[model samples]
Target: MLIVGAGLTGLCTAVRLARAGLVPTVIDARRAGSGTTGHSSAKVSLLQGSMLQRLARHASTETVAAYIAANRSGQEWLLDLLRERDVPFDTRLAMTYAVTESGAKDVEAERQASRDAGLEIIDVGQGDLPFPVLDAIGLPDQAQIDPVATVRALVAELESFGGRVIEGIRMTGSSFTRPWMVSTTAGEVRAEHLVLATQAPVLDRSLDFARIKAYRSYVLAYPVADLLNVPQSMSLSLDDPTRSLRTASTGEGDFLLVGGNGHEVGHGGSTQARVDEIHAWASSHLPVDEPAWSWSAQDYHLTTQVPHIGAVPGTAERLFVATGYDKWGMALASAAGELISGDILGSAPAYAEALRAKGIRTADITETAAQGASVGGRLVGDRVRLAAPGSGQTPPGEGAGRVEGNPVRPTAVSTVDGRTCALSAVCTHLGGVVAWNDAERSWDCPLHGSRFAPDGTLIEGPATSDLEPVTE
Candidate 1:
């Protein structure tokens, strides 16, 4: 067996399959867990900040119940593995709070949905939040984890089971014949079963990417002087420009992680402004110094509000896929791993069966079509704009980038840290025009979330290759 990603979903699935007497080879385009899994907030909780309420809008009560069941099983499985491996994680209350009246209504709806899903959520009207809130809800004994540590433990477990892990291997193509062949940058490898546990499946055969929309968000960690005063709960805000708070202990000292201000991958302008917004909020509310570290993360979400985990639509049960966690990947990834492995080993738990039983709804299809139309609009509009550009050679100012040239071929130019680079502005995934992300100093695709470094190195998303270098 072969897995095409080495994040939590891929590694967990690989480890489980290995324990069941199958040696799976897990490969990653980058280092293991260096993608979304590493950059995640790593809050494992059932009270997922208005998620249940949003899901109830498009799904039946039974489907929501099954979804919660699957997530519960996933959480238990992860906690057990962490305990067995001696990985240290903190148990804290996971709270969802709202400051505005509209947000309060959403939280009330979420509270009702939580009850319907059988979660023991408590209504904490105005909790220990620094600011005033209209409403607050929490589930006690939820978990917060160091994502990097969790990945390391999983890697060790997989290796102990005689599973091989290879990094820096990009999957170029695949042939789903008997003994399926996967073409990577390293070489072609054949396996009977293949699992795509990537954030977004690289393959487009099943149109899974079409069913989901990609979003990018930022996280900033600040060194805190008064850890005692900091909220002990892993908390999220149910309002626009969402605010997520959780404390962390690192080698340097304790810190507060503030995350949110999310937008579509490349549509939102001035990514730096989003970071500024976070900084402004932290400065106003938290007793923290300058940010010690900051980074951006990308995730995909289905309108149906449930992750898709099963055989690819037409792969004859040979190709498995798991994606669309909707920013709550910590436990869902584990659940996805178990479900996919169970499908292969024929011992999938009852929750896995329940999740599979949940079918797609018409609302989901309509949303998917709407997202597709938006992507189409971006492609046509961006191409037309790029076609009306000026000279392609002039270098951009430091820390800036621009797309220049004619309609037939556009060149992306960026200068960062006193260096400059030029590459094709076209995304390798589906020819979407790449836009510069001022915050991360990278080119991002507006179509399917593919992102690239300043020199055009493929960072993540469904793109299979780096942006081509532009010749004079």
Candidate 2:
């Protein structure tokens, strides 16, 4: 079998299959931990902020129960793996805090949903935050970790079992026969089963992109001292422009991780300004010094709020895909690993069976329509904005990018390190007019969340090909 990603989900799935006497080849576009999993806050908890409430609203009661079961099972499996590997992790209370009245209502709703999903959460008048919180829900014994370390440990275990990991190779396309064949930049390979564990399935057969919304968020690590009074627990906000907090103990010493300020990919402007927004918030709220390092990550959110973890429809079960964790990939992906492995081994659990039972609910249909309308509106609005008279802008300076030329034949031009390049501004995956993400210096698609480098190279997302080159 061949797995086409090496993040938590892929590695977890690979480890399970390998332990069962299957020699699986895991392929990553870059080295292990080069995807979204590495950039996460690394908080693995069943008490995800308001997630149960959102799920209950969009799915059946059984489905909500199944979702909770899957996450709990995944959480347990991960703890076992950590114990076996002897990787030290911290156990902390997980809190969802609301600072505003509106946010308090969200907390109330989530509290009820948690009870329905079988979690015994307690109300806390005050969480260990430097700022005041109106109300908070605390779930004890949740855990945190350095995600990069976890990925490395998973890879080591996989290798010990004779599993092969190939890096710097992209899965461009595939063909299914007696044995499926995957085409790649490195070469062609054959496998009995193919698993697409990427953020979104590269294979477009199921139209996965249209079924979900893609978003980009930022994470900043800053040096903090005892003066900050940083909490020893994991916490997330139920407010807009969400704030998540935790700590990392590294060779450089302990640091604080502040993450939030998410926006739909390619639709928002001034990525640096978003980073600045976070910096300002942290500076005012805590004793956060200038960020030691900052990075960004992209994630997909299913309109239904339930992850898709089964075989790609119409693939005869030979082709499988797992995605839509909605920023809770650590636990959800671990769950997905066990579920997918069970399906392949012909011994799936009842929770897995419950998760797979499918009949589109009213919530799903409504969310799908809303997502479609938003995409459609963006498609029309972006084209008009790019087509307006005098829309062509000046060539961007070094370390910047801008759209030029008319909308019918727009060009994405960027200058990085004193070198300038131009490419078709239209996203290769869909016709959504690409926007310049000043932060990453990449061309990003507003409609479906595809991204490309300054020189027209694919970075991530559903687009299998790089942006087409155009005249400078």
Candidate 3:
């Protein structure tokens, strides 16, 4: 067996298969867990936002039930594995609060759907939370674990089981023969099957990229003296520009993680401003001295608020993909691993129905043009237009200057004391024009919320690589 990523999903799959007396070779472009798993705000909960309601509408009750059961069972399986291994994971019963005024209806509908699916959901007004909640739903046996620790433990276990985890090895592509051949920068890995579990599938042409939109989310971890009245909770707002909130603890102190303000992969504006907004919101709710760590993560968003798990559509026999988690990758990834494993072993999984449900098709070119026109209209009407060269007489900041070229395509020329250096205005993240974030003194991506330091180091992503420098 061969796994393309070494994150939680890849590692877990490798471990499960290895323990069953199969040797799985897991190769990651970077160190294990350094990808999405290391940065995840690992919350194990079945109360995915508005998912049950959404699923119930299109999928059958059995399909929805299987979806819920698979996730719930995956969580139980993880907890049991941890217990058996004596892994010190923090298990807490958490509640999902719908904060918007009209969220009551959504929460009620979701609770009913969950109950119909044979899942336990305690109502907000019921004895679920200790404090007052506007409208909430509680999954009885939810959990939270330190993802880094869990990954480390899993890596150790995989080593013990004689599974190979090779880091700094890139898997470029693959070919299907009798077994399977994965071509990598290092070499070719031949195995019976392949799993593409990377955050954004590098093999873009295999699946509909539009079916899964990339979204970047920010997290600010603060060191608080005490946790205060805020219990271990995870929340999602129902209003437009949805936001999520959750809290976790570290040896230093308890930290609050706020996520959201998402746009399509290359469509949001100003990463630092977004971070500042999160900081401001956090200040009002919780006391913070300084953020212990501030970072961001990106995930694939399914239009239907569910994952796409199975063989890549219109592909050969052995290639499989698991993506479109929509900010619920931790639980969904585990479920995908189990499903993929079963499929490979020639057994049908109970959750396969959910995976087989059709995804939303991409818009046609004419429709796409209309959508682009609408977005362009909004951009023009908005006050904050894209930055351009010499748009105004004043420089962008103390160290930044506006060079004459094109305002829309203005060169971001920087000076150290009084030396000149110029670079392309386009952000490499998603080609959204880059602008100077005066407050942070960094290049900001207007399209997908990636931030780069003054010298062009990636401070945040969907774009893992740094900006390319322009030369005279």
Candidate 4:
């Protein structure tokens, strides 16, 4: 069997399959744990902010309960593995808070939904946070860990079970015929079954990209002088431009992690400004000063509010896909492993059945339509803007990029660290115009979240190929 991607989902699924006596081969375009999993806050909890409440709007009570149960099982399995591998993790309370009256109502709805879903959550209004809050609720004993370390432990386990992982090799294309043939940057390989655990499945044939929306959130880590006053809990706010706070202990030092300033990828104007807002909030609210580290992660959300983790639609049973964690993937990634591996091993769980059993809700259809309209508008609008006279003539200054060329052929030009590179601006996946991310210095696709380095190398998202080099 072949698994594409080596992040949390791919590695976890590989470990499970290997433990079950299947030697799966996993491949990634980059190093293992260097993608979203490496950048995640890594909170393993069922009290996922206001997610339960959001799910309730699009699903039945039982479906939400099953979602929580699946995550619980996933959490238990992960903690067990960590203990067995001697990986260190901290047990902390996971919480959701609201600062505004409207946010408080949402929190109340979340509280009710969480309680109905069998969580022993408690009211911790205006919790022990350093800053004041209007209301809050928490679930104790939820855990947090260094996601990269956890990924390393999983890799060790997979290797011990004889499963192989190859890095820096990207899957370029695939043929779904019997003995499925997958073409990678390195070479072609054949497998009896295939699993795509990437952020979004790279293939456009399945139209899986249209089924979910892509978003990016920023995170900043600041050094704290007094650790005693730190939140010491995983907390998320329900207010606009949501704020997420947690404490992290690392070999370098202990730091307070402040996250959340999420927006649809590519569309979020001035990515650097998003980072600055988090910095401003952290400096003002917490007992922190200069930021020690800052980064961002991309996530996919479904209108159904449940991840799609089964056979790739239209790919028959030979291919499978797992995505749409909606930024609460620490436990959901493990759940995906269990569900997908169980399906392959013929012992899929009941929760997996429930996730797949739910019929499409009208809310889901409406949201999907809205997202489609937005995407269509972006594609057409971007093309028209790029086609205008004097659109891409002037060279961008240092640490900047612009889309050049006309409607028929667009070029992405950027100068970073004294080197200027020009490449195709059109995304390799579904032909979306790429936008420059000021913070990360990469070209980001507004259509499906595909990103590329300054040199046009594919970074992540559904794109399988790198941008073609353009002669200026």
Q: Model 2: which residue pairs collide?
A: none
What TM-score, to 2 decimals, does candidate 4 have?
0.97
Question: Candidate 4, residues 192-302: lDDT per residue as tens digits?
Answer: 889888878876555667777889999999887666778888999998889998888888888889999999999967999999998988888888888988999999998
TM-score of 1: 0.97
Candidate 1: tens digits of C-alpha lDDT, residues 254-287: 9899999999999989999999999999989877
Candidate 2 vs candidate 4: which has greater lDDT? 4
> All candidates' lDDT scores?
0.88, 0.86, 0.66, 0.88
CA RMSD per model (angstroms): 1.4, 1.8, 5.0, 1.5
TM for candidate 3 is 0.79
Tens digit of per-residue lDDT, candidate 2, span 98-128:
9988888999999999988788898877878
Candidate 2 off by > 4 Å: 176-178, 387-393
lDDT of 3 by residue, 1-472 (tens): 7888898888877777777677888888778988778888788788877778877765567667777877876777677667777776665555556546677677778778878887777765522334345777776557777788778887888888899899987776666444667778787778767787776565654543444455666777876566655545566654454556667777666776766665553355456678788777667655555677777666765545456676775455467777767777777777776777777766656667664764343333333345456435533432245334443344344565433446455466565455555666566644655556543456665443455666666654345456666664
Better of 2 and 3 by TM-score: 2
lDDT of 2: 0.86
Looking at candidate 4, the ten consecutive residues that score lowest on lDDT are: 387-396
